[model samples]
Target: MRKTIIGLDLDRESSQISYYSERSMEPETVSIQENQDRYLIPTPSDLFTLIEGKVELGQMTLANFLKTCIGYIGPSVKPENVCIMITMKEITLAWADALRNACQMIGIPGEAVFLQTHRESFCCYTLNQKKELWIHRVALFEYEDTKISSYIMDIDYHTKPALVRAETGKSINLGRQGARSQEQWNEQRDARFLEMIEEVFQNDTFSAVFLIGDSFDKTWAVESLQYLWSNRRRRVYQGRNLYTKGACYAAMQRMDIGKRLDDFLYQSEDLVEHNLSMQMEHRGKQSTHMLINAGTNWFEAEYTCEFILDDTDEVVIYARSMMGGEAESYSIVLKNLPERPKRTTRLQMRLKFISQGRCKVTIRDLGFGEFYPASGKVWESVLEV
Candidate 1:
């Protein structure tokens, strides 16, 4: 059976979905309307004007729409082999769990449903692009509801998974339909707006900038567009489907199939898309062991490994970053044993990815035979690299 995956870009204002299939060979944005030729579907509470006392099944609403999204996407989900990914601005744990449950009912593996913040989709989209685009810093300007958010995609060749960090959500009052709508308005406000944008971009250099939002048209942002075009380092791309396409890229990354990663890992405030592993020696021989695999959603990245303490009390784990740079090695200290012989103390080491910034490491001592009962002592450490 062909693999099917859905990537959902959700926010309170609007939501979009991009679906990929083994047969299609490319990702395409899904249209929610019955007859309209559009990709994004508005979920405003007031959009339900067509129906009266009877609420329509497919009627989109802020409340019921998000809750039933999993079931709504169920038809696109393949039985036994499928994946569902949701990228949102913010979601409660309860809603995420509900999504997981809905996935389970449709035969999708509980672990296959990936949840991440929206900026992560931005990082994934940019990082997955050809490395040539990363010559300098990459940027994205999102204009929504009279507000502008500027996100700078930071690239660090040093870090592994979270190499791409987004610095964004900078807002200013380019108010709705004010001076921008007036064709013969005074040049004073326009000049100040241009100056404000120049100040924002004065200190930074961007290789590529993606302009997104309904207000991005020529009519509304003539001066701002002129400023962006004149001062930009390279090309400035515009579109409403970038995030949804980026989400699709993320979903494909999980399938371990069509998506190609030249050397891209999407990492954000609460998401870690890279695996953490370690190289160790066993019985006078050297071997590699994987602790956490990449492409795993950070919320579900908790894993435990129990092993008896070796001759040394120190354990070292390396985050094998793709491409260049030395692997990041984190040495975990397993201290305060029962003062017994080597290999007598059994230690259970657990690595839990707490946030994009760090991973929490917990090491507990589980004893060997009857003579050395489990001591119940533990050592905790944080891997912030």
Candidate 2:
């Protein structure tokens, strides 16, 4: 039997789940209601708020909730063969850890659980569609709780491994805060939505547009709906399962189950854009050694190395952009060091990212096996990429 690949759209308010269907070969959204199209399962109001205080309790609650969700998949499914991708509006290192802990409590391996942002989920969903649907720019409009948001995605084929970028755009409060009547609010909403569409679509050609939300319909968006479907002449679809389906696709992509997106790379906000390396003597020859690699999450990117100082009191790290550019070197000076023979001073270097464009570097002096004696000294610096 094949492994069970799953995508879960987890949020504070509600959650949705999708699973890759072996028979249909597509992600099918799980409906909470037996004979309805409902996909949302109400989440606990205090689930996220309590994570800041009682961490263990929060993780337990999350694990129990996830266990309930997994029960809906099937009785024959095994936890060892499940791969789950969790996508949210935004993910911090703390939340990522909590989610992974929850999965671990439920017998899921750490390697089988993944986390991503909604923007990446959007890219996965769009790129997985037919080529014609995403050959050009793709637009997405999401309406929720009287608010509307817009996002645009572009692909740069000029780059090797085609870069896919999705950015959040305009947002507006379309709720009936001070409404005269339903009809008046609908009319005003239609006009405002049309203006927003014009602002985004002007002087740009989009191959497809997606509307994500539960409340979107033709009743209030008659003019805007007609404009998007007819004037733009692009494929328009409305649904609430895009993110979950995209999460499923992300899992599939990570597991090498699909080749549709093998040539594309999605650079999300948390990804590192530069490669960190240094020159070191290895096996009697000088070579460039990688310290931290590009395309790694900032929170998880860290490296440690031990080296002998050849003839300098300074440690240098080279940063090279992934987009093809000259490597820039940043140096950290070792201060108040004990006089030692050449190549006799052993040092330990540690590098870690604080954010996308910033990193922290520390070097500690470790005397060469009692020959030079220990100085117990440490040097710290920050590198801006």
Candidate 3:
């Protein structure tokens, strides 16, 4: 069945959404509420009110309420070379869940909805070009309310021309860091800021830099702007709509609604870049089965299989990480299994990741059939890779 793909961008001040439909030639960015800017939606502090002590969050204007009420749920993620599974706050999932409900109210399937953080959206925005984005590494400098942060995204060539290695910086409060006057602030902050930039450039290379946040718009008031492009190219932008549009493009790519994105594989904390497989004896020959495949979202990686224990209750699983490094093997023991005739004991195994460092494994005994009957026994395990 055709999927109703939509990109949902959730932010603090206001939340924006972009969508792609086959009926339209291009993606559309519209306000979540009526009578609002086509690309802007309001977000209030109190989205729900208690009428007689019962909160009515299921109103038709729920999207409208989210526009003015929801705070930032998901934080920014930098695309890195590491294949790690990152968990989100329960509050963040609540935002995505609510948005999916909103999509259902509008005749869209909840399964088709996707969430993108503003930072990941920025990567989607710049990586769409044929060779431009891959040709040159890009950096993002954000200037918000009272802090400054940065992200470095570069092309990784470890294995073919595959993905981007991202590095995110800790944000520093500019208001507390600056002096009394703008000029004095620059005079005091230029050296420190320049040192930070120099340290990064000393270790890496960048073809272009993106200056975001409202602070960049007021370069006239800040003198540190001069060093933004001492030897490289720079792009200055100030707004919130860019993320929504990028998210729209992301949705299209996810559903293959438009041109496919082939070259830019983002290896962020949210992306899993490893696969776990086991080599076992099937009949008289050896066979391999993947418990979890690389390039799949960790949250979505789950599988169950029933196999007969060969000669040992111990099983060895091999993994290849996104780092494109050597293959590592992990051994798991079933601990307790009823002794039976060779190849007559049936065992059910399940694989799932509870975190980047932990993959939960569960094994249960199903016996061999009516002849062998059931054991009503189970064993839980943790496979650390």
Question: Which stretches of candidate 1 lie above 4 Å from their native place?
Answer: 21-24, 44-76, 91-98, 130-133, 157-162, 175-193, 231-233, 271-297, 304-385
Model 1 is weakest, by summed lDDT over 10 consecutive residues, at 50-59
Q: Tens digit of lDDT per residue, candidate 3, span 1-385?
A: 3333445555455556555545674555655455665554554545433211234554345555532322221122111211111111112323434554554554444344455455566677677644544466677766667766777777776655567656686456656533377666655556555655666666555666666655554444344556554554444445655566667677777666576668557666755567788887766888888788776545555678988877887767788885678879877776767778888888888887665446788888899998798788888777776
Provide the TM-score for each candidate, comma-separated: 0.64, 0.82, 0.67
Segments of candidate 2 deviating more than 4 angstroms: 33-35, 52-56, 177-179, 278-284, 299-317, 329-352, 360-383
Q: What local distance difference test score does each model get?
A: 0.67, 0.86, 0.59
Q: lDDT of candidate 2? A: 0.86
**TM-score for candidate 1:** 0.64
What total of clashing residue pairs does each candidate reach? 0, 0, 9
lDDT of 3: 0.59
- Weakest 10 consecutive residues of candidate 3 by summed lDDT: 78-87
Ranking by TM-score: 2, 3, 1
Candidate 2, 1-385: lDDT as tens digits: 5789999998778899999888888888988877898889787777888665656789988888888777677777777788999998877666776887899999988888888888889999999899889988999999988889988999999888998999888888886748468789888899999999999888899999999997787888999999998845589999988999999999998788764776898877789999999998889989999999999767657788898998888988999997788999998999987788899999999987767788989889999996887789999998999
Q: What would the TM-score be for candidate 3 when compared with the true structure?
A: 0.67
Q: After superposition, how far is residue 130 of candidate 2 from its true place, in Å?
A: 0.9
lDDT of 3 at 361: 86
